[model samples]
Target: MSSSMSVNPLWLFKVFPFLRWWPMVNGTATRADLLAGLTGAIIVLPQGVAFATIAGLPPEYGLYTAMVPAIIAALFGSSWHLVSGPTTAISIVVFGALSPFAEPGSAHYITLALTLTLLTGLFQFTMGIARLGTVVNFISHTVVIGFTAGAAILIASSQIKNFFGLSLPRGATFAQTMWAFFQQFDHINLHVMSVGLVTLLTGILVKRYTPRIPYMIAAMLVGSIYALILNQSLGDAVTGIRLLGALPSHLPPLSLPELDPHALSQIAPSALAVAMLGLTEAVSIARAVAVRAEQRIDGNQEFVGQGLSNMVGSFFSAYASSGSFNRSGLNYEAGARTPLAAVFASLFLGIILLLVAPLAAYLPIASMAAILFLVAYGLIDFHHIFAIIKASKRETAVLLVTFFSTLLVELEFAIYLGVLLSLIFYLMRTSRPNVISVVPDPRASHRPLVHAPDLPYCPQVQMLRIDGSLFFGAVNHVEQRLLELEQEHPQQKIIIINGRSINFLDIAGGEALVQEAKRRRRQGGDLYLYGIKPAVMEILQRGGFLEEIGPDHVFETRDEVIRHVFSVLDRDICMGCQQRIFHECKALPSPGGKPS
Candidate 1:
């Protein structure tokens, strides 16, 4: 190959990320991926339909989402094992956002969902282009756990009517749902209840005993069989059992989302919420699986992949989708070798959809509800919830607040509230940096500074260490502490700050230090700093604060700062004092005006 042809442009990899891993595709890798893809395809059949029910979309739309979006996300994203499809959380959020505006599963609602997906995709794509992937870190893990648990409960509550064959209104709140169920206790349909219970119990048992089998498919089959027998022995009208109806068996057809200005404006807020939540879920899952697979994950790339998936999927009769934790985990465990596995999975899902779409007519609504109940149960991370409660009261509070907000408020607003509370808690913690007095340990060979309150301090000098960044938010608290120290020890006018722990120094912090230096100078004392980082020193210098504080006032070594401060101390006070905390104190003149 010529030099021009041999040298591939770096931008190509950005546009086509799969090229990076394409070289790993050999016979062995392809075979492994095919097997993994087959496994994933089998698992997604029931899950796709279930997630669609949660999203208030038709069953086939879930399979459509699992098809086009899965392929697109796998081809563009950074993870090799992460399978992007309809997820429990995203589905719930979609339903919650659109149910109030239009009837669930209606044409208008589907259009609204498609539009929302497009807007969310645009937002995600913009963020990826801006390289704002790190922004997801602000949504704490506790917040996600809490929000997911709350959404799970909502999912289960939404299905209560189908599970018990009650005539409850759709989109009822948790409290309202419970109240309605209680009022209709006497009219419960035992036939539907029996099918749901059988499904739920079968799922739990299969998952516990036959770990290799897909529990959802197993449970669904058992429930369907039981329902069929009941309807055969009795009659459909007599038993009052309802079926999910047949699904369309074809490729995802092209569709256009409504682009009216009013529709766009109405859906903007919910779109933003879904965008953030979806990105967080996708990136977090990718990183998690990457850890086990020993692969590197690029968050920005993952964002781009998800953005493209949803944007393209919007045109394919698919609703919003995100990373599926169960599917991704299963993909990895089934020995997926490359992103091709996800692509294959999507292809296989399409093929399976074509073959089995009519069979959905045999599936009972009660059985589907039973599967959803299991899905909701699995969404709660009980271990992490308990760990958060036991490890930190602050985290526990965040978890509880997020949990309650998700239950009490609108779903989108609940996400915002949880994020806002997390940011507030973070600011509160960082605003008050730890300012503690420290002294050198005499017994140590190098006399390293230690936080020992009981150790005697030099009567002429006070030393303090700050254990956080010096930002604008922290300046006031540090300044007040400095003033308090000065008031408490009037004789200790020469204050030395151990600045090793201060990693960042903002302009306001620099100004505060300058003002403190001037104040000390006016009082016949001085301020000194040692072990400051180079970056912080650069800030001090660029702002001219270092010049105001005097370049000589800063030192790189503790011994130099101590020696310089001691040389300028009031010798008269040292002569009368007996606290010889510093080695230089032995050189001070005695009361008779002679060298000791």
Candidate 2:
């Protein structure tokens, strides 16, 4: 083979990720993908329009978003089943961020949205290149559950005016919306409410009974048909039922976001919020589906894929997009074999758009609101929410704080707050490592160290096992505990630390240990360590802490520790003590030069 062929393919895979799965695209796989793509295309028709309504964008923009972004993400991302497009969380966030700056659905609003999408893409791409994918892990799963549930309520509340046919102000707060809703209770349009109720009920029944059918599409069709009947009987003038005018039946046209300094600066903050949320949604959905598809997901690759999709999508008049859990789940269940399924779905969506765009003229705003209500309801993960509440008070607090913050504060700020609280909680736990007193289990064959408070301890020596990293944050707590132990039992001057569980030891920890060793030596006893990991040993050695603590004091085995300490222990105390916790007591001699 040539030297060129002998070269590693890893670099090539980084540049062109689809190459990894291209060889698997056989006739069988293509056929499966085609079917899955068709199913996904059909499903996104109603969802694209509904999600667009939620985002305060023109309905066709939603369909356009699904096309270009989906194709780009599928080609570059590592997951075989993940389908990227507009999602509820991203949509609602876009609306929340931009609505204050410009009127929703206006030319100015669209321009701002495009700029936001471009900025978000840049953030994601930069993070991916910098290999900051692990940063998302800091945003706890509890935070997501809370944020999602809160966003769901926002979605439902946003549609109250349309759902009930009341004239509520745009950008109303949840409380204001509800208050206005009840105030205008007498003026509710019966015809619009009837259409929304019909759609909602139809969706509920169809989803419950007919699992195979796309319930949104079914509900949309039923709702549209029912609205037509009502309008014909009562006439449009009397019914007050509004229709979404016909959409343009064409491809996503070339467009440019305003790149002025003012526009960029204005949108930067919201763009970051969108970028983080989008990446979280995409990477999470990718990993979730990858588990079922038995594929390994590269989170950085996913970030890069999502970044490129939005960056390119911005030029094609597409709004910000991310991984759609519903569409991705459906794609996997429909037997999608490769990323080609997602590519096909996007292509089919474009084709489907050309055919169905004009049909949207008949789509009632009330019915769209009803569809969004269902979308909102679906976003709440009741199982995880209940589990978090039942399992842990700490997690429950995080969840509730995030959930309430999402409603009361700026949507993006809520995410930041949740992440901050999660980090604080994590730091609180790690900063206080478990400094447990342990004894050798007599019943176990290997006599492993166990935390048995009932076991009698030696008076001359104390043994402690630290169960967490000894970093800067935790060194103080560990040092304080050691100081307390010395104060409580001054006679037990010699100390042994089981360092096996200490995965990390920083400069501060090493310095603390050196001080501890010096203090112990002044009291006529020395600090010793056993089961110290090689990495930790290297740190201690590099810092000259091992010299201060005495190189001979560190042992590798429990037996070695016992024998060395027994030889140096106060044999006079052992002569009278009844507690012979260690088996070494059986053979060792007392201070009088006789076996006790």
Per-prediction TM-score: 0.96, 0.97
Q: What is the RMSD, in Å, between candidate 2 and the native fold over all Cα?
A: 1.7
lDDT of 1 by residue, 194-248 (tens): 9999999999999999989899999999999999999999999999999999899
- Top TM-score model: 2
lDDT of each: 0.92, 0.91
Question: Per-residue lDDT tens digits of candidate 2, residues 139-209?
Answer: 88999899999999999999988988889989987788888888999999888999999999999999999
Worst 10 residues of 1 by lDDT: 587-596
Candidate 2: which stretches are off by over 4 Å?
A: 1-7, 589-596
In angstroms, how far off is 17's CA in candidate 1?
Answer: 1.9
In model 1, which runs have C-alpha deviations exceeding 4 angstroms? 1-9, 576-579, 586-596
Clashes per candidate (backbone, < 3 Å)? 0, 0
